[model samples]
Each structure stands twice: as C-alpha cells, then as structure tokens.
Target: MTMMTLQDDLTTAAAKGNTADVESLLRRGAAVNGVNRFGRTAVQVMMMGSWPVAQALLQHGADPNVADRSTRTTPLHDAARTGFVDMVRLLVAAQADPQARDNQSRLPVDLARENGHAEVVAFLETLK
Candidate 1:
C-alpha cells in the first residue's frame, strides 16, 4: 500500500478503537505521527474510550500535544470534551499539555466543565 494509505489506515484503526489493528499497523512502520486525510494524527482521531489505543500510539511516539488543524485542540481537549477521564489521564501521562488552548482559547478543563464532567473538572483543577 502507498504510505498515505498506510497512514490513513493507522488513523482509521485508531479511530475504530481496534487496538490489534493499530498495533499491527505500527509494526508495519506506519508513522506514529502520520496525519490522515483529515489532516489529523491518529491520536487526534483515536476513540476516546480506548486507553489501549492511546497507549499504543503514545508508546509508538505519537505526539500528545498535536492540536487539531481546524479547532487547534489537542487530544486532551477532545478527551476532556468527550468526558473520557481515563483517556485524559492517559494523554496527561504521555505529557499532554493540560494548559493547551483551543481555537476558542479554552483549556481542557474548560471543555470538561462545559460538558458537565465534574470529575474531570475536579481532576484537572488539581493539575493547575
């Protein structure tokens, strides 16, 4: 397959939360930081509920701080927006910047609070 196709596949697998496929794609030399057709890295589109997928990407050197091309929101922003606290934790462990702002100039904690994720808001407050 073409390199672009391989990279897209990696992002697709990550988005699907198919950990095995993500791992296999990584093993096949998919660029851990490759952006898909949407110009988003796998970590950017990865399923919010799949910590294993996040872990695989992080271990493979996926940049935890990469902001979305349009929204300028990092993976942690997405996780916090979706109320996936575990995913937030995983990204933080991988050195995601909690203070990173999006196009709206709102932090991940702001998104978490806006989404009514009290636990996530609480967790992020401790990091400040």
Candidate 2:
C-alpha cells in the first residue's frame, strides 16, 4: 500500500479534528499551508469548525491568510461562515486581511451578515 503524503494526512487530520495526529504530522514535515484538491489548507479546514484542530494547526505555523483557489477565501472567511468568534479573532490577530474579499467580492463580514451570524457581523463591523 502506498503511504499517505504529508499534505494528505494533514488535510484528513484537520477534517477529522485529530489534533494529535495533525500535530504529529506537522512535526514530521507536513506543510502547514498545504492545499488540498479544493485549495483549502489545514488552517482553512480548521476554520470549517474544527477549533481544536485549527488551534493546533495555527500553533504549528499555519497561515491564516492562505486563500482558496476559486473563491480566494481566507481562513477568516471560513470562520465567519461557521460563526467561530474565537477562530475569527485568532485569524485577525494573526494578521489576516480584515477586508479580504472572495471571488464574488464578498468580505468576511458580508458573509457573516448573510449567514445571520449577528455577533460575528457585529464584531466584523467593529474591525472596519
């Protein structure tokens, strides 16, 4: 059987919320900013609602500003979509572009508002 590539394991670990495995893979030379078939990095995967896994990835040097392929959506965009206030704050503190827009020209705040995440929308408004 062929062994899984580091990027593949990292993506799977992020998706599964496997913090320990993610950390291990990261320490074993996994690319913290590795992009999957969807152009999502480990950090983006974590922003998809896996806070613990995201935190682990972030601590390991995952780039919060990494953009997806088509939409160019950052991890902050994923955080907003999921209403993860802590993740949003972490991404912001990590220097994520507060005004970064997707292919549709929608910013993270716009997405939060569209998704009815009042608290997230309010926080994003404060950023501007």
Candidate 3:
C-alpha cells in the first residue's frame, strides 16, 4: 500500500475506535500525524470517547494540537465540543494547546461551555 493509504487507514481505524488497527498501522509505518484526504489527522478524527485509541495515537507521536485545515480546531476542540472530558484529559496530557483558537476565535473551553459541558469547561478552566 502507498503511504497515503496507510495514513487514510490509520485515520479510519482511529475514527472507528479500533485500537488494534491503529497500533498496527502505526507500526507498519503510518505517520502518526499524517492527514487524510479530508485534511484531518488521525487524532483530529478519532472517536472522542475512545481513550485507548487516543492514547495509542498520542504514544505514536500524533500531534495533539494539530489544527483542522479550515477551522483550525484542534483535537482538544473536538473533545471539548463533544463533552468528552476523558478525551480532553488525554489530549491535555499529550500537551494539546487548550488556548488554540478555531476560525471563530473560540477556545476549547469556549466550545465546552457552548455545548453545555460544565464538567469539561471546569476541567479546562483549571488549566489556565
């Protein structure tokens, strides 16, 4: 398979929350930070509730702060937006930039608050 295929596969596996596939792809030379055809990295599209997937990607050097092409939203933004506090914690542990602003100039905490995720919002606020 081509390098691009590996990247796409990795992203797909991560999005599906398939930790084994994600780890296999990484070991097979898939770039941990590689973007797919959608211009999103594995971490960017990973299932927010899947901590094992997130952990595997992060351990393989996936960039926790890598922003989306159009919105500039990081993995932290997605996690916070979805009210997945565990995913947010995983991203933060990987050094994700909580202050990263999206195209709307909104922080991850802002998304959490907007989405009615009080716990996520509170958790992010404490990092400041």
Candidate 4:
C-alpha cells in the first residue's frame, strides 16, 4: 500500500479505538505523525475518547503536540475541551504543551472552562 494510505489507516484505527489495528499499522511503518483528511494526527484523533489508542500512538512515536493544520488544536485541547482527564494525563506525560493556542488564541484550559469542566480547569490550573 502507499505511505499515505498507511497513514490514513493509522488515523482511522486510532479514531475507532482499534488498538490492534493501530499497532499493526505502526509495525508496518506507518507515519505516526501523519495528518489525516481532518488535519489531525493519530494521537489527536484518539484524544476524543481513546486514551489507549493515544498511548499506543505515542509509544509508536506519534507526536503528542502535533496540531491540526487549520485550528492548531493539539490533543491536549481536545482532551480538556471534553473533560477527558485520562486523556489529558496521557498527553501531558507525553509532553504536550498545555499553553498551546488554537486558531482562535484559545488554550486547552479555556476550552475546558467554556465547556464547564471544573475538574479539567483545576487540573490545568495546577499545570500553569
């Protein structure tokens, strides 16, 4: 298969929370940091609710801080926006930048608070 196809499969696997598929793709030399059609890497796609997939991607060298091309939204931003504490922890341990801004100059913490995620707000406050 083409390199682009492998990358697309990797992102799709992560998005679907299929860790086995993700690991398989990585073993086949898929680009861990490759952006899919949505301008998000595998780890960024996993940030929606799949910490295991995110971790798998990270272990395979997916860049935790990689941002969406249009919004500049990193995995941390997605995790915090949805109050996904485990995802936040995973990204933080992977060295994601909590202060990184998006296209709107909004940080992850801002997104959390805007969504009424108090626990996420407190956690991010400690990081700052």
Each prediction's Cα lDDT score?
Answer: 0.93, 0.81, 0.92, 0.84
> lDDT per residue, candidate 3, 50-81, as tens digits?
99999998898888988888889888999999
Candidate 1 clashing pairs?
A: none
Candidate 4 Cα outliers beyond 4 Å, as residue runs? 1-4, 37-39
User: Per-residue lDDT for 112 in model 4?
Assistant: 96
Best by lDDT: 1
- Models 1 onward score TM values of 0.95, 0.88, 0.94, 0.90
Of 1 and 4, the candidate ranking higher by TM-score: 1
From the highest lDDT down, the ranking of the candidates is 1, 3, 4, 2
Most TM-score-accurate candidate: 1
- The local distance difference test score of model 4 is 0.84
Candidate 2 per-residue lDDT, tens place, 16-62, comes to 87888998998899889877655577786662666678778778777
Q: Write the per-residue lDDT of candidate 4 for residues 4-109, one digit (tens) a residue.
A: 5787888888878998999999999888987776666788777367778887888877788888877888889989998988888888888999989999999999
Candidate 2: segments with Cα more than 4 A from true spot: 1-3, 37-39
Candidate 1 similarity to native, TM-score: 0.95
Clash number by candidate, in order: 0, 0, 0, 0
For residue 6, what is the lDDT in candidate 2?
79
Residue 13 displacement (Å), model 3 = 0.5
Give all candidate RMSDs, comma-separated: 1.9, 2.0, 2.1, 2.4
Model 4, TM vs. native: 0.90
TM-score ranking, high to low: 1, 3, 4, 2
